[model samples]
Target: MYLYPLLIVIAASSYGIVSTIIKLAMQSGFSVSQAVTSQFFFGFCIAICIFIFTNRTKLSFNGVKTLIFAGVFTGLTNIFYGLSLNYLPASLAVVLLFQFTWIGMLISCITKRKFPSRIELISLIILVAGTIPAAGLIHVDLSQLPFQGWLWGLAAALCYSLFLFVNGRATTNMNTSNRLVMVSFFALMMAVFFQSPEVIWNGTLFSEGLWIYGLALGLFGLIIPVYLFTIAVPKVGLSMSSILGATELPIAVMVSVILLNENITSLQMGGIVIIILGMSLPTILNRNMLSITKKSTTLGTK
Candidate 1:
């Protein structure tokens, strides 16, 4: 039981390390194509191994196809995020990526054809207001920073939300390991299609330091998080899982500051706090609502 919470923290920390690790790989002369491709390729292999070990039933082609559909968005999410980190400081880049929470809510609103609740509307307003300082746009010189980074960061957020939505709606009959293997397979395919065709043609998939970078990314970015979440979420429930997952933002920011030596302002730190508060509101609200409903039901029964 205690192990589950530890796993959650480990998963969150692993996510936090990804941006810094990518920067390190790039500093070692890795191209975006190489970095993204190797990460997904090695990740795919790891997923396949897990599936082989755990899968007992015959494979379901329908489930595999559904996961593959979701995999395209996941692939785009990673590619865009990697590009964003290349152009922006990891501190600022992570804040941009964290915008996915509100963006995902907006997507949910649009898809359901319903307006956001008052709480959600307020959260959105706070999120937008928070983004300015969080992005360091208010204090930093905007022109000096890469505009493309901002674009890619927001694009990554959109794709991340879309991936979640798609993945959630995908068939659930398949076991988790099998689903992961299928999704990883297609994510690797999309990585190759979108970024590294030339590298594939050049037959340089095994370049120096490729596996080292790939192993770090695969283990941290995909394997660890997925495996830990599978174990932790059912035990802790979504609310606690999400609150614990919030650790990712602070860890990512601190890692960047420590390893990359990026300077962040006080105003930006305040904005990050505000954004996290806004992002967490929905989960906290849901948990409270559930508690109130349970109490009311118990009283009625009495």
Candidate 2:
């Protein structure tokens, strides 16, 4: 149990860091499609190598249906997210993507006919309030932001939320490594359709020194963290995993501040706190509810 949460935190932190590096890579001359394709390709290679080294056997392709589903959604999520970065700043793009929390909750309500708990409701409100500062919405000039960027960011959030929802259902029985490999393979196929082989083969697609960044991006950004999340989700369950995964936002802010020398205002810091509080509310309330239920059961027994 502890291991699962720990892994999730680590993976989330890595993802936050990777987003910044990817943004940097894009500024260094890589197109959105090129960056997405390169990361998936290298990530696939790394995952395959890990599979081979660990199992000492041919990779398993047992869960074809689930793999295909996961792969398609994952590919779509990355493509849209990469494209979103072209229109939005790294921090803003990430904040928008985090809207998946609300989207996921709405999905649960619609699909399961369940009302959110009181704590969840409060958390959701706080989370939305927090976004104002986290997104610099109050300070930034909305007129300066492109409408297309906002569309792409929202689209990315929806796609990512769907990816999480789909993967939650798909990986019921599959091992982590197998699921990752299949997803990467299919994502590679999808990316290839959009990427020009001429550019990639001629080595004209990436900026100088991008090979190193791309390799790191693949291994740290995609392969290891994704594999860890796949394994962690099964152990801790989706809701808890998602809640804990909120760590990525603050981690991203901190990473940007440190690595890119970006300044975060006091209002932005307040927003971060609110977001964290919102994310933690569900888990905290669930635990308290369980405890109370257990206490009542004990009293009734007595």
Candidate 3:
């Protein structure tokens, strides 16, 4: 049980590091399409290798239909996300996407007919309040930021949230590794269609050490973290996993500060604290309320 939480933390941290590296890769002249497609391609290869080494018979195509559907959303999410990176700062884009938490909750309410408890409502409020600081919206000059970038970022967030929900539903009976491998296969197919074959064959794709960089990007950013996430999700449960995954936001900020020398204003630091506070609300409040209700029931019995 504890192992799942720890794995989630590791996955989140890995994602944070990858976010910064991807930004650097973009700065190194990789196009958004090239970078994203290459990552998926190599990620597919790595998944294949892992599937082969771990156990050949465990891989199954039974879930291919669901995996392909989920992969379409996943591919689109990453493509738009990469495009947003071209226009927005890594930290800003990440904060915007983290809005998925609320989106997911709302979706749950609609689909599950399960309204959030008072504690969950409080958590939602804290999450929104925390974003003001996390996004540096208080200090940043919006006039300079492109509207297109913001649109792409929001689109990416919505798509990513959908991907998460779909993937969660699809992997119900599938092994984590098997599901991941199928997801990668479908993602690779989607990427191939979107990427230019001529450029790939002409070796333009591999120029500027993309061969090496692409492999590393796939392994660290796509393969390992995703595998870890799949394994962690069932163990910790979706709500806890999502909350713990929010760690990626701060990790991204710190990675940008350290690796990219991105500036972190005092307000931005405060925002981080606010986000953390917001994330804790659901866990803390819900647990306490549950305890209180249990105690009240015992007293009523007397």
Work out the TM-score per prediction.
0.79, 0.88, 0.86
RMSD in angstroms between candidate 3 and the native structure over all alpha carbons: 3.0
lDDT of 2 by residue, 1-302 (tens): 25877887787777777667777777777776767777777878887887777665556677677677667766776777777788888888888777766776676567668776677678777777777787566766668877887787778677656655556664545567777888778867777786543445767545455566667777766776677877776576555566666777788888888877888888889888987887777767777889999999999999
Tens-digit lDDT string for candidate 1 (11-65): 7678778888788888888786688888888888899888888888877676566
Off by over 4 Å in 3: 1-6, 170-173, 196-200, 205-207, 234-241, 286-302
Give the range where candidate 1 is weakest over 10 consecutive residues by summed lDDT. 236-245
Ranking by TM-score: 2, 3, 1
Better structure of 1 and 3 per TM-score: 3
Task: Write down the lDDT of every candidate, Cα atoms only.
Answer: 0.72, 0.72, 0.72
Candidate maximizing TM-score: 2
Candidate 3 residue pairs in clash (backbone atoms < 3 Å): none
Clashes of each: 0, 0, 0
